[model samples]
Target: MTKLNCPFCYNTIRRRSELHFMCRGRPTGARPACQPELDQVRSNLTGFKEATLPTFEAVSENLMLPFTKAHCPKCGGETTTRACSHCHTRLPMEFGLDASPMVAMVGARGTGKTVYLTVLSNELQKPKIRSEFAATVRPIGEGQDGFGAQDQWVRESIHQVYEDRKLFSTTAQAVDGRKAPIVLEWRGRHNRRFVLRKFRTNYLSFYDTAGEDLTADDVTFKLHYLRAADYLILLLDPFQLPEVQRLLRLPPAALLHVREGKPPIDVLARVTEALKQGDHWNGRHITVPVAVAFAKMDAFNQHLPETHPLRARRRTLGGYDEKTGRIIHEEMKSLLHEWGGDEIDAHLSGHYRSYQYFAVSALGAEPDYENYLVNPRGVRPDRVEEPLLWLMHKGGLVPRAAS
Candidate 1:
């Protein structure tokens, strides 16, 4: 009996023995068709107010019994689509029964969370990344072959950034305005114990939010997912750092796109405060593994030499490279102190039991600010895959040695 958290609702899911199912819809061998109706619970949690397949709960008298399958009461057909008992949001059974780690993506506005996430998902599915891990990636949501809201939302976001050359505009506050999460199953012959299991399939969920959503006391309960996360990917925009600001000679148009906000330390402190309020980490130090990444490293290219680890173009990482990971981690740490962000590193050291720093650029080159488009050289993603990969390594989904 694995205890899992609903990535969408942040509610504890009693898996295997207690099961919830949603109708697949339509008639089935004498079974009635399920009509789409308003699922208020899901709507309240996800802001997905549109009518959806109804979900119902079932529990076995025998606690040890594996209650894997259920029939829709409205329809007599066997339904395999499982949903959260609390919010009625459909979730993959792979995660429900297997207990998977959840990673929350956090960053202030202008950190390019949307852009980085888009590129990361794209890179994971590309041949370069897929072949290295011997992995298969599939988005898990309504419909088949990556259909439904999750796939469509990611598709559109990817198209906008990679094809249209325009970055995602500032995210709007509220559940409805945020980007739908990138949820999927990462099945592969990877993981540290691959020699034993031979293969492992992991269901991963990446959740992001508008910068405005963090640090507010009012949102403490509304954003409970942060506390429930097993791992976190914290992104920091170098442009926001005062030291970077004083040094960079960015164009006025580029500066216009930057969101005015507090230093990264304030963001980290507020998140720490919120985690303290949670039941799990009510202490000074938190146990969640965090990948603290400095996004948009391209903005500082002129300041760095070719030998800088951040500028090294990666061809393919057949697997997680611990040596390279360590080099970049230390480089970012030293750079933080140089940029007056040692406080950010200090806060993590004092408050986090485990964390790693990284330097990444979603777009390998700075976008043409005056033209309001991606770099003319196009969207050359650089090291956008490291943060999530590190979290995956911690989750035991991928091996530590690069092949």
Candidate 2:
């Protein structure tokens, strides 16, 4: 029997060892005998060499196990892996049939990330994007998907503060027990049909992170997940534009910590450093097609027409139009043109890589917790789906059939 390590508590024990297996902390009596179905998994991989390992598709088709040797440092339980080597938490290799393209959400504090994620969950359920993507939004991890465990603080933070109409902050008491990370999956158009007209690319896994985490000094563990990420959606709050403008006007005034501000500059600076670090670590230009998303455009919509003198320039800036459905204010385009230049193109000539400018509003109408995000005139999104679509296209998750 091969010795294995517990993935949960990082405990290591051998199959022949006389230790009861406990996962993550839960003690399983006698390492519950492997079911007949799972026993076959062990049999198949018995003599298999690591070099000729079966593909994810093969395991999914055969209903084989998705387990690997890992050490469980806590319980001395060997054979512990992402799937339990012992006990009933065996892998459902079936779920492994499709390997999802991974995407991570990272941004600064108070960027309305939670609200944006909450709304993205609801948006993905819509017909057009849902059909095109063949995926659904869901909560995964720990109590949900039995994965690497979800962060409870993030889950409750959104629910209590935004969903439950309760105030939330680094100081405020949580109203909704604990927050869970929202994990959504969906199938993209087959690439063979679009590319070589042979096979579908891969499934997509969208993971949302809390703003607080992105700003932390040490993102060692968090940075790991982002290494192989296909795309990164960075939320940039328009509220920060004012602060940046204010500072630019008074270069010597010192950067003041604005109250209830969205996307603190200090946090943004740290996030930037982390991204650079990730690029260094991965040895790949962490240029994972970023969407410097201007979230909650409704607040900035009123200032659109009057934002800048040039009307066409304002449209290029980006905005949402109630009449035309999705509108890009010229001012936003101007800003992006100023930052990255060239009408917010995919990439600039020399500096920067894949990037785009977008304006989006999560709730359309401001989420008046006191008023339940009331839109008496009926709900209308101001270019809410552009950023996601842009990302999907860049990720090859959605095919440009015409191409």
Candidate 3:
């Protein structure tokens, strides 16, 4: 019988012999001999034999056993595993580079993260940016053809910028479709190069999960990627300021649950909960800095509350600016310090020991869909350079340029 224990709860997955699975193994239960105590459970069952092992050759087929339903300890909901919507599977570890600086993105839906990624990847292809940054861009794990499929869908969904440029494409739509893993290699001007290989490339890993999946109680993907990140770029929508205030106060009116949208705090809570539940996260203190980018700042800066003096520092609400960047960073840190993120920061400080902040706008101007034509041209991406610059500096991938 396949008897595998729940890594999070450490409870033997109560299963009967009639269950269709073979025994994976049980926890030792003495004391976690390692920092990530939960990961101590054995995952490699290479030679273990079973009386009735299913003959399916693929790992995906093997996961569908009768007693394999993972339960969320919090709400007891069937734990949902995180996977690429395009590929319907956990991204292959081979797609990751061993020495690349690992950066991760976190944000609410429609905060322009996907679009930003499309633009950033496309921009990296440019010689000015690529050469200036001393970085080479390529798909690490997923091959060109595999990633090509995903990009095709993305290019087709939104209008294109270059009629012949083909825009950006990804390979996530196959049943076993490959997810194109993008790797960025930063070669500093000083001829020193850093190939951040942990997640397998000097590039950032963009994580996009459906909002519904993130909110569920039994999230199986929790803690898996937390340790993979060296920095986190968290996007925010400035238009949701009112909702943020309500969440902070826990007012009864806010409890009514606005139908049109969800609050950031809820998402933040889910993320933190996932981090706390992970069995493998090294807990080395996330040396990564978190940028709470108030995306679409252009659309909502004038609406800031009078009590929030930070509004006066705005330099064109929706546009990106370096001066405004410094202000938002300070304000965000202050807000986090007040909201108990300081404790999290203190924990990370012990590990990463160094970090910084920035604000950015991927699109400089709004799309003119006057004709309903896709690929509306004239994409003026502003300060799209800031975040990468920050990551490179912090990762020690670059040296201070001589004056």
lDDT per residue as tens, model 2, 1-403: 2223222111233442222322333234645323222234322322111221111111121236433333334332343323434322323222233344455566655566656665665565567555544544343442543333332544564455344554333322111211222444453445443344333323334445555555446752334445445566767654455533442332221112134333444554554456565542345344666666776566544445654332222212122222221234344566644533342233222223666556777656654433334344434455556666667666545544331
- lDDT at 21, model 1: 79
TM-score of 1: 0.90
| Tens digit per residue, CA lDDT, model 3, 65-155 | 8433343232223322322221122222222222244555555554556556656666655676655545555333334322344445444
Q: Residue 393 of model 1: what lDDT?
A: 78
**What does each candidate score in C-alpha RMSD?**
3.1, 11.5, 15.5
Task: Estimate the TM-score for candidate 3.
Answer: 0.51
**Quick one: ranking by lDDT, best first?**
1, 2, 3
Q: Of models 1 and 2, which has the larger TM-score? A: 1
How many backbone collisions does model 3 have? Answer: 36
Q: Can you give the TM-score per candidate against the true fold?
A: 0.90, 0.55, 0.51
Q: What is the lDDT of residue 199 in candidate 2?
A: 35
Instruction: State candidate 2's TM-score.
Output: 0.55
| Overall lDDT per candidate, in order of appearance | 0.74, 0.44, 0.41
Residue 143 C-alpha lDDT in model 1: 66
